[model samples]
Target chain A: MTQQDRAHATREAILHAAAQEFDRLGYERTSLTAVLARAGLTKGAFYFHFPSKEAVADALVERQTELWAQVRESWRLRGVDPLSALHGMFAESADRMAADVVLRAGVRLNADREVGYPGVPSTHLMWEKLVATYVIEAAERGDLRPGVDPEAVARTLCSAALGSRLISSATTECADFPSRIREVLGHVLPCITAPAWELSGSQSASEPA
Target chain B: MTQQDRAHATREAILHAAAQEFDRLGYERTSLTAVLARAGLTKGAFYFHFPSKEAVADALVERQTELWAQVRESWRLRGVDPLSALHGMFAESADRMAADVVLRAGVRLNADREVGYPGVPSTHLMWEKLVATYVIEAAERGDLRPGVDPEAVARTLCSAALGSRLISSATTECADFPSRIREVLGHVLPCITAPAWELSGSQSASEPA
Candidate 1:
């Protein structure tokens, strides 16, 4: 393999290993040595990729942001309308968080008080901006109801999503998370969308949670 | 004052002093000695009320819950409809958290991982259950849209309320929290309520966020 490709592979291995450790043991308890062992890499190789466990956790957060950006791009490529793109994005994003260990670990670390770095823009705000971008696009497309404010809609949606996940983690079983998301979307959709607007394909945002 | 009245006053002073410290210095930085001084009470009196800083913080949480219950009871006495009571409860709760030092401290302490007691029920669940109770009342009053699930609406509202407050704290100015809450209520209201439903005299839920 090329030297550059080998370096990239090493970084990915460290991040994956770190994510698993962070998810299972939390940021406080996960150690560099355990991560290196999990990755089956030498200490030198691990050091070349990440300086510390904090750096490894930081990379996971950055990776989640990148994953979301890619999701937006894919929706654009699929020729979906802006409103439809949003419904699709929420569904896909929820599925990814549930199924992808690295992304889930990033989410957990984002909430970890010890691991959080103040002055950095919140990952929650980044997601809000992304959703706001789509809400603005939907407005430009004349898909929103009259007098609807895109920024307000975006803020509410972002908050609702976070609250749903937090509440679910606290009380409801994990399997019910998607249902909670659906309930939120179903109620919220009718408020902002023009009556004529519809979610793309067979999907319905108005479905009961 | 009666002996019971004097004892209750002492408890209130200790709680108030602890709330201000917890609000300003956070749960970790606040000290029992400081709280005693602020309350103008002896260690003996303080010990009669709370055993430790953790107990003081827990009392703050319990007080917030009690305050919300009183709000609900007040609404019932005013003969407000269930859905309208829900909106008023949100507005008043938001206002109280902003204006009342004790309530604000309770909120911050709830989010503090170092202070969290794992086995205790999340205060968020208590609010969710309270919201759900109103939703059921709304449905029985023939106020809900056909086929709308009261539980779903309740869950969405609770999550939305939480998400709005969290996001506002993370980025938006604190003053904007009410607007964020309004945006959420406006959107979610349309999906669950019968089209003829209204939010009581002079207060409209459909205001553009």
Candidate 2:
């Protein structure tokens, strides 16, 4: 392998090691020495790549945010109908909660403000904005209920989606969690559906569409 | 005064110290030494009151749960109708969230499981039972829709309530959070209203008594 490839591999190794140790022991208790130990590298090597513990945390946050955005964009590019797209998004999210350690740590950081990680709050805001944009697009296309403010509905939906993430993260034995989230999304979607009943012929359905 | 009073004072001091430290640095990072220092006691005195960090967290959880139960029972006893009682409950919870640090920490724990305390799974289950009890009572009184399953509806409501809690926790400037919570609850209450929306009379009345 080239020198560049080896350097990239070392960087990825440090990130992976940091995420696992931070998740296992948390941010403050996790020392630079432990991270170097876990990565099988010296402190000098660690300092060569990252400046501080906070920088490592910031990098992880950025990676997780990119991961979420990529997931959303990939779904959007497929042009799935809005509601199904939402379900797919949350289902994929819960699936991550069930599997990814770095993502889980990122979620835990989202929950506690004391553990400051860069881009965490912005990640949340960005997720909400994405949900709102799609819902508004669906509403414009006559796929959503009539007379509903897509932004408000999007906020509620985003809230529910985030809450689902929290629930999935809180348990280890939540084996049926992804299905439960999909089911709950099914129940909540109707509330935001236009016409409120008939899902199309109810009161709001009369709006020009 | 009495020996009981001295013991109680010491216990209260420890809890207060622990709560502050926990809130300041979270459950994992807050050291027992800091808690003892904050409480103006030695490690022996701290251990006399609580055995471990986990024990302190458990005590806080127990206390919060008992307080919320009383909060719910008080709402029922005040003769508020089921719907208004439900609204009032959410509003009251928002008020509590605004006022208390410990309760805020508990809400954070409930939302992001990997942070704050590790007992978030049990906390989520406790909330499920809490909401389930109210939904069932409301159903029996002809307050909920006929087709709704209390358990399922309870889970859904808990999800939304937690969703609202999440928004509230994440934002410091949303002054109308309580009203927004009520609005979401208002929309959801109809979907689960008793006798489940008859075709003719659904438009005129605000959810039946």
Candidate 3:
């Protein structure tokens, strides 16, 4: 392999080891020596890649941000429609939550002031804009109901996806996660779409109100 | 006050002191000496009430769980319909996210298996059951749509609420939190009711499936 490729692989390996260690041992108890020992790398190698624990953490956050960016980009390539893209995003989050609860927890913990990755303003604005753009496009294509607010729909969908990912971290069973995503999408998508009118009031008065 | 009431008050004072210490210094950094000092109680008195740090944590969890139970009882007394009562619960959680972020964080962190709280299962299961009962009641009351599974709806709703509380802990701002809870609830609540429907659709073209 090329020297650059080898270096990239080594860096990724270090990060993977670090994530596992941090998730298992937590931030305070874990040490660089332990990380190096687990990674099977020399102290010099560890230092060369990450100057400190915080630096490694910053790198982890950066990596996650990049990964999410790619996921968003894929949605853009697949379809310019908002509702479908939003559902796809929620589905993707559910799959990730099922596979790696640690990753979900890591994301929640790292986003705080303690980890200190403020992220870009553009990135901060991305979810809303992406959803809003798709919603606007869908409206133009006559897919949405008359007078539905794209911004509100986008915000609601984004919040539900994020909230679900956060919740899945605490749950022991991942069996129903995808179905939960579908359930949220099913309720939320109809509210924002033209087809909502087709649903008759077939539900009974169940909850005490 | 009666002797029993005085004793109960002192025990609560100690528990409150312990919660604050754990929240401020975290689990590892906190010490029994510091907790006793903060509570203005002697070591003997502290030991009389609790044997160890874990005991204190258990007490706190029990206290919070009781608070939740009281909230449930209060909701029932209000005589609202099931769906409205469910909304009231979400709204209370939102308010508490602002009112008691620290307690919420402690509960969320304690729930983490990595963090450890042996007592969480019984307490958490009780809370979940209570939520499920309310959801089922809502479904039966015609507040939720037909064909939506109450158990699934309850589980997802509880998860989302837990997620929202965790997210709230990471920030000082509540400006967006209330709306965020509402947004998620708006989507999920319909699935538990009859003839499920979401609120609105995006204005963009439908993306490729």
lDDT of 2 at B15: 80
Candidate 2: how close is chain B to the reference, as a TM-score?
0.67
Instruction: Supply DockQ values for each candidate.
Output: 0.44, 0.26, 0.16
Q: Is candidate 1 or candidate 2 better by TM-score?
A: 1
A83-144: candidate 3 lDDT, tens digit per residue: 56656665665666456534543554454323112122323235556778877887887777
Clashing pairs in 1: A159-B163
lDDT of 1 by residue, A54-88 (tens): 99999998887788779778778878788787877
Model 2 chain A weakest lDDT span, ten residues long = A200-209
Worst ten-residue run, lDDT, model 1 chain B? B200-209
Which candidate would rank higher by lDDT, 2 or 3?
2
Q: Tell how far residue A15 is off in model 2, in angstroms.
A: 2.7
- Which 10-residue window of candidate 1 chain A scores lowest in summed lDDT? A200-209
Cα distance off (Å), candidate 1, residue B171: 3.5
Interface RMSD of each: 4.0, 4.1, 5.3
lDDT for A19 in candidate 1 is: 88
Alpha carbon lDDT at B205, candidate 3: 16
All candidates' lDDT scores? 0.75, 0.64, 0.60
Which residues of candidate 3, in runs, are more than 4 Å off? A1-8, A23-26, A29-45, A96-109, A112-159, A172-179, A196-209, B1-56, B77-81, B100-130, B137-143, B173-180, B195-209
What is model 2's DockQ versus the real complex?
A: 0.26
